[model samples]
Target: MEQILANGVYLGSQYAMIALGLTLIFALMNVLNFAHGQMYVIGGFVTYTFYGQWGVPFVLALFMSCVTLAILGALIERFLFAPVIKGSSREESTMLLAAGIAFFLDAVILLVFGEKQRGVPKIVDGVFNYDFRLIMPYDRILICVLAILSIVAFIGLMQYTKTGRALRALAQDRTAAQLMGVNVDRYSMIGFALGAMLAGLVGGLLVTITGVNLGMGGPTSIKAFMMVMIGGAGVISGAIWGGIILGFMEAIGLALLYQYGDITYLLIFVSLMIFLAIRPQGLMGKPWG
Candidate 1:
């Protein structure tokens, strides 16, 4: 039980970081970024290259991952999304664009990184055990702590910073925010970049434990979407809640998997479908205006 709980917390923290990026982008642009998982994979690859291959320090490699993804995100928003958003009359167009971007990123990742899985050397070498019941690797603990700190820092940024305020205003009401002199285009790009950066950061942090591969992108996005839906789409706190809930569910399901076999995921997803059917707006989200 203790092991399960610890696993839940560890998984929840990392999952929340992934969900946060998706929710932030959704809140700001009303766009579901299918390419988000690709961005995460890129982050992991970047870190793997610099830290695992080039022998750079892990922290610097992580920074490079964040920088690389942030630039990619900014460019994508400026060149692809911004124009489509301005020209399109139908929201479906944006969704299509997102899908296209996802495919493009997948192709790029495969071409550049190949199909092989990649992992980094453990940053810390040890284990933490409490009464032999709650045992975890030292590196996982470090990553979990960093993930939590990153989330808290993000929350603080949203609540206290000027950039965050502008982004929030834009998210709340684009027309009203524009009327009040907010630069919608500038802030939108910034928000998207920030969202991508968060994804990269989490990818870098988890690469030590999970070891990223090119194929993980689609499933990662799906799981992130599940977390977003569980908490409430486009709601930050809801994303966190959804992540933690899904994390615990995964932990429990895995624990039962040996006994129950494939029914574990079936049950978990079915429960989510039922919950969404009952409350489509989600736990914290209001109906779209």
Candidate 2:
């Protein structure tokens, strides 16, 4: 039971991070980023290169990847995504463009990294064991702590600061925000950057547990999409909730279904479908105005 709970919480944090990125991007741009997972993949690779290969401190490697991914995200927004948003019907175009970007990045990673999976050595190797039953590792503990801090910081940014106000305003109403001189374009870029940073951070963290490979992005992206939908579209809090639920479900599935890992996702899909059939806007989503 303790083991199950620990795995659930650890996985929940990763899912929340991924879901948060997707929600942030969707809230601002009114489009889903098909390539967002690629950023996560690249982030893990960057950390592997630094911490695993160059012998940089693990925390330092994470920081380096965070900064690099932020810059890369901004560049992607400016060059790849921004151009498509100007079209008469940008919702579809932006999504398609992002899909194109994801495919291209996947190919590039495959060519560069090859088919081999890469591992990130433990930053610290020790387990917290109590009563010979409860056990937790330091790295997973760190993942959860960082996840909490990131969520808190994200909420603070959205609620308290000036730039955060601008982002909130843009999300609530782009045309009205523009009329109020909020600069939707700039805020959208910032949102994308922040979202990408979150995804990259998760990627780096997950490499410690799941290792790094070209295919990691696809399943993660799908799970994130499920989280965003199940939690509630355009609702950050919903993503967090959805992530936790999904994580717990997966953990339980592992305990009960054991050998049927795929059943977990199938169950999630069925649950989501049933929920949507009853409430199309999602768990916390307000009907589109």
Candidate 3:
């Protein structure tokens, strides 16, 4: 029980970070970024190349991942999504564009990174064991702590920064924000970049634990979408709650169903369907338009 609880907390923290990025993008642009998981995989690859292969410092590698993804995200928003949003009459256009972008990124990843799994060296060694009750790896603990700190920092940025204020204003109402002197195009790009950066950050953090591969992108995106739906579409706090809930669900389910041979995810999806049917708005999310 103690181990399960500890595992839940660790997994929940990282999952929440992933969900945060997806929810942030949705809140700002109303676009479901199917490429989000690809961005994450790219981040991990960058970290693996630098920290794992080239002997660069881990911090520097992580920074490079964030910068690379941020730039890519900004360029995608500036050249692709923004124009499509303005030119298209159908909402499905954006979804289609997102799907196309996901495919493009997947191809890019395959061409550049190949199909092999990649990971980084653990940042810490040893395990934290308490009389066989609650045992965890030191690297996992460090990553979890870093993820939580990142979350708190993100929340603080949203609540107290000038750029955050501008982004929030844009998200709340684009026309009103423009009327209030906010640059909608610029802030939208910034929001998308920030979201991508968050995805990269988490990917870099988790590379030490789970590793990453080209095939993980689609499933990762699906998991993030599930978290968003569970928490409430376009709600930030809901994303966090959804992530934590899903993480614990995974932890407990896996622990309990290890003997059942991969039925845990099947159970999770079934539960999610039931939950959504019962309360579509989620725990704290208002219905998004």
Candidate 4:
């Protein structure tokens, strides 16, 4: 049970990292970015190429991958989201464009990578032995620590930094924020860049935990969307809570179903449906007026 709990927390941290990025983008943009999972996968591939193939240090590879994706995200925001936002049909256009971009990227990846599952070398080897016979991987512990730090840093930025304040202002009301001298376009680009960087970081860590392949992004994206919906669309705290809840639920659900010889995917779908039905706005979501 102790080991199970430890594993759950570790997995929860990973899920939190991915879900936080989704939450941030959705909170400010009010659009679900279907391309996020692809970004995550691309980050892992970038890390693998830089670190594994080019022999760069793991930390440096992670940094470079994030930076590269951040730039890509800025470009995407400028070219793809900008026109959609300015057009007459805002929501529909934005959704369709993002989804199309996601599909196109996925196809490109499939052609390039050829559906091979590949894992990155662990950042840290060996396990930490806890008192009472509990053993946990040092890398997983690092993930949990990083997760906490990332959340703290993000919160601190939002609460204390000028740019963060501008982001919050834009999130609350774009027109009002623009009138108040916030550069809406620049801020939106920055927010999207940060979101992409977070996805990249999580992707690098994910490669250490599980092998990556072209097809993995789709399921992960579905799970992330479910988590964002369950947590609330526009609330950071909601994302955090929803991520942890879903992570533990998934872990426990899989364990139980394994004992009963039931299908894991079915359980996941059923739980998602139940959550959607019970709280359409999600647990921490404010009702849309």
lDDT of each: 0.93, 0.84, 0.91, 0.82
Rank ordering of all candidates by TM-score, starting from the highest: 1, 3, 2, 4
> Mind giving the per-residue lDDT tens digits that candidate 3 earns over 1-289?
9988898899889889999999999989999999999999998999999899999999999999999999999999999999999999787899999999999999999999999998778889999999999899899999999999999999999989999999889878889999999989999999999999999999888898999999888888999999999998778888999999999999999999999899989999999999989989777777554
- Residue pairs with backbone atoms closer than 3 Å in model 4 (clashes): none
Question: In candidate 2, what are the lDDT values of residues 1-289, reduced to their tens digit?
Answer: 8888887988787788889988988888887888878889998998998989999998888887788778888888877777778754646788788888899989988998787899988866898888867788887888788887888898999899998899889888999999999977788889889889888888877778778999987777888888888788888998998898889988878877868656876886788899889987778888872
What does the lDDT come to for candidate 3?
0.91
lDDT of 2 at 147: 80
* lDDT at position 154, candidate 2: 88
lDDT of 4 at 177: 96
- Per-residue lDDT over 186-267 for candidate 4, one digit per residue giving the tens place of the 0 to 100 score: 9999999988888888887677777578887777777778778878887887787777877787677676678767676677
Cα shift from native, residue 53, model 2 (Å): 0.7
Counted clashes in each candidate structure: 0, 0, 0, 0
Kindly report which residue pairs in candidate 3 clash with one another: none
lDDT tens digits, residues 1-289, model 1?
Answer: 9999999999999999999999999999999999899899999999999999999999999999999999999999999999999999788988899889989999999999899999999999999999999999999999999999999999999999999999999989999999999999999999999999999999898899999998889899999999999888989999999999988988888986868677767987999999989988778888772
Regions of candidate 4 where Cα sits further than 4 Å from its true position? 129-133, 263-265
Top model number, TM-score: 1
